[model samples]
Target: MPQMLLIVEPIGQRAERGRADGEAVYQRMLDFAAELQAEGLLLGVNSLGSAAKRLAKRDGGAQVWDGPFAEAKEMVGGYFLLDTEDEGVAMAWAERCPAAEWATVEIRGVGPCYM
Candidate 1:
């Protein structure tokens, strides 16, 4: 089966709302995940921490930068792995996501890889 990955991005007022309504948001996600699981559409789900780090190579050496405060338009807050046959259906699921009302849900098809 084809898989769709939903990447959740929260920015600006959305980010603030996520913090202010953390528990409610968490419950909403839980409910959404449960619905997907009941429909056999969800494979897995995870929420990311605010702490983030950037790895870079500067003049042949390694550099590490810490952030939850990067000057970026949005931060990746969570993700869901979904099993589905059609891209349109996967997109529809994303549209139904609770975060869709306040955040951006980016849908991407999972590609196959060979070793």
Candidate 2:
């Protein structure tokens, strides 16, 4: 079995005006994650801060960018560290994700860090 990082991106405005009701949806999303955790399927899940507070590192200087990195349908607002046997199993979880049908889940494996 391998550990995979499941990054979730919301396809619509998740934290903005007119989307105030989004809080409820967000709560549901949390509930789903909790359920997964209780089943020992999910290792951990975390929500990221607004993209407005993001900083990009270049050659020398750090560039501060606005929140919500892209104008696409969704933005990566959170992630889950999944402990799964393979990508197929991980995809199964992603398909069940509340945000999956609408949002996108980018799966990445933990790589070796050369000393």
Task: Please give, for residues 33-100, the per-residue lDDT of candidate 2 as tens digits.
Answer: 88778878787788765545668799999988675547555556778777776788777777777767
lDDT of 1 by residue, 2-101 (tens): 6555555755544566665878878999999999999988888998776789998989999888885658767788888888868888888888899887
Q: How far off is residue 3 in model 2, in Å?
A: 4.5
TM-score of 1: 0.79
Q: lDDT winner among the candidates?
A: 1
Worst 10 residues of 1 by lDDT: 5-14
Q: Model-by-model lDDT, in order?
A: 0.78, 0.68
TM-score of each candidate structure, all chains considered together: 0.79, 0.67
